[model samples]
Target chain A: MNIIISNTAGTPIYEQIKEQIKAAIFRGELKEGELLPSIRRLARDLRISVITTMRAYNDLEQEGFVVNMQGKGCYVQSQNADLLREHKLREVEKHLHASVVAARLCELSDDELLNMLKYFMNEEDEYE
Target chain B: MNNILELNGVFKSYKTFALEDITFALPRGFVMGFIGPNGAGKTTTIKLILNMLQRNAGTIKVFGKDNIFYEQEIKEKIGVVMDNTFYVDEWSLKDIERTLKPFYKRWDSGKYNSFLSDFRLDVNKKVKEISRGMKMKLMIAIALSHEADLLILDEPTSGLDAVARNELMEILSEFIEDENKGVLFSTHVTPDLEKIADYITVINNGRILYSGIKDDLLEKYVIIRGGLDVLDDEFKTKIIGCREHNVGFDGLIDSSVLPLLPKNIITERSNLDEIIVRFNNWRENK
Candidate 1:
């Protein structure tokens, strides 16, 4: 998995790490049971504090994205269908919230909003 | 988990400078970068830790024992690399190791040899013939060869080139793989600490300015820039370290005050260098 960190970003280093790991998991680049680098190894490689790395790993474990084994290291956890669906739903909810705000700002009717979304979805599918 | 090194209310004084109530702790498996300007008591505190200088007050502990009470035992478990070299100028790498090996109970000859080769140092080269980087490598090789749980270095990268400095950082990062190992290196080069230090203890004018995780220190302060018009007495009162110039006003402000700040002021996350500069400024202005 590719992970890049930017010191200038407003996001804290640990948050950047967590977001990247989550994205990689969602993208299927990191498969279930795939071993992640040991905390020290990742910290050394990234030139970041091990505490920052530990925080990221701890968050991942708490979110059920990874499992940390004593002495062995962290591994990607198996994502059940329900968990995957829940994650996708949360992601969609964020977009839907933004879309609702934009629709209200533009004073669009329900039919107009639905038609615009359909047009964009079909446009994206044509490229895919 | 036990602290690898602990200092409690440490106080020391000299004719020209004094370190007052200095305190911090380094947990095992982490590297704590001790930082300060010249005459900031960084070296004095280090000397106190090694029991080289007597403290006027307070206690220092290594491996849960008083530094003075178990000085010899503590010394055995501690590896030190100072700016000055104690090796004879004419001695070769092998001679240097052979002379110093007897002092440490756990010194590994094989490990020393391997490190020497890994560092590309010739065993036959005289100490005087080697470069500054080579000398530092030799020192680190010796430090690691003893299997010391704690490595204390003062300005180890001061005189080295950029490439050499990066190499040393890589070596240090690798050295902390063992959960029992802890490193405390004092340096003015903040970037090095930004890269690998888990915790940073910044001191100035013989006083502790800040001591905690490296990330938190970076996050705690912000650099604010705006026009001179933004410099009101109320805002100026909140500035940690700021300067007003003909162009505009630039200052350091604590992150907690950001939300209360006027929207016109520009704020950016402060780096370790900015934090040091601001602290130095705050001390100077005070």
Candidate 2:
């Protein structure tokens, strides 16, 4: 796995690792039933604490994105269609919320921003 | 077995110096950084744990047994690499290993020889013939040669170059792969600890300031900087190490107070080195 830890991002190191791994799983870069690197080896390679990586793996397991087996290692859980859809929808809502706030700051009306988004959506089809 | 080493109310006193209420625990299968400035009791705390200096009070346990009461059994499973060497100057690398092998039941000559080769030390060179970094590496080689359950290293990377320091970090990561083993590494090289330490125990003025998870400690404080005009007495009281000059003001503040600050002031996450330096500034602020 290719992972780069950022020092200036303000988030804790473990959280950064957890988020990146979660994103990879969601994007299908990591396959279901595929083993993640052993916690110790990953730490050695990344030059990070083992506890930090262990926490990242544990958080993934807690959210049902992975399963950890004793003596073996962590394996990615197969994606649930409905669960992933809900997660993606929530992510879209978060982005739209930020867009609305930015539009308000620029004094753009709600309908104007909605129309802009619709135009952008149609603009993508020509390229495809 | 949760904690490999524990110190409860450990105190030591001298004519002009003392360590007060020193209490912390190194959890199993983790590296705990014992950090403090010079004369801040970092070395004294390590000495107490190793039973090198007598503590005026409190109990210390190594692997669940009292360090003093079961010194022999405890020492066998503990590997120590301090700043000073205890070997004769005339002893070569081979002679030193031979003399120390019988002390550890789990000593492996294969591991010793391999480490010596990896560290690029000549076995024929006497202790006085090598440089400071080499001597430190030799000490670490011996420490690793014995399969000790607990490794207590005091500033092992200070004199070493960046390459050697990186090597030590890798070696330590592999060593802690076993859940039964742990390390209590005491050093002011906070950057090294930032990369590999699971827990951080900060000492200042001979007292424990913070002891817990490394992330929690880093998340606790933030570096605040702004114009000198922003330095009001009320806000200054909340900061641990407040300072001001003609140009601007800067200090360490608890994150809980971050939201209360004005928009003009900016805050950033603090690192281990900044935390240690700011901790010393706390007394002056008072």
Among these predictions, the greatest DockQ belongs to 2
Q: After superposition, how far is residue B255 of candidate 2 from its true place, in Å?
A: 1.3
A61-107 in candidate 1: lDDT tens per residue? 99999999999999999988898798889879988998987797668
| Model 2 per-residue lDDT tens digits across residues B1-286 | 3889999999899999899988888888899998988888988888888888999999999998999999999988898888878889999999998899988888999999999999899999999898877887788788878878899999888777887788788788888877788999989888888988999999888989999888778888989899977788898888877778889988898998787887677778889998998878987566
True contacts kept of each: 0.56, 0.65
Model 1, runs deviating above 4 Å: A80-128
What DockQ does each listed candidate score?
0.42, 0.54
Question: Whole-model lDDT for model 2 versus the true structure?
Answer: 0.87
Candidate 2 ranges with C-alpha deviation above 4 Å: A93-128
Q: Which tens-of-lDDT digit does each residue in A1-128 have in candidate 2?
A: 67889876877788898878888888889999999998987887788888889888898899899999998999999989987887789879988998996797678998899899999889987779
| Stretch of 10 with least lDDT, candidate 1 chain B | B262-271
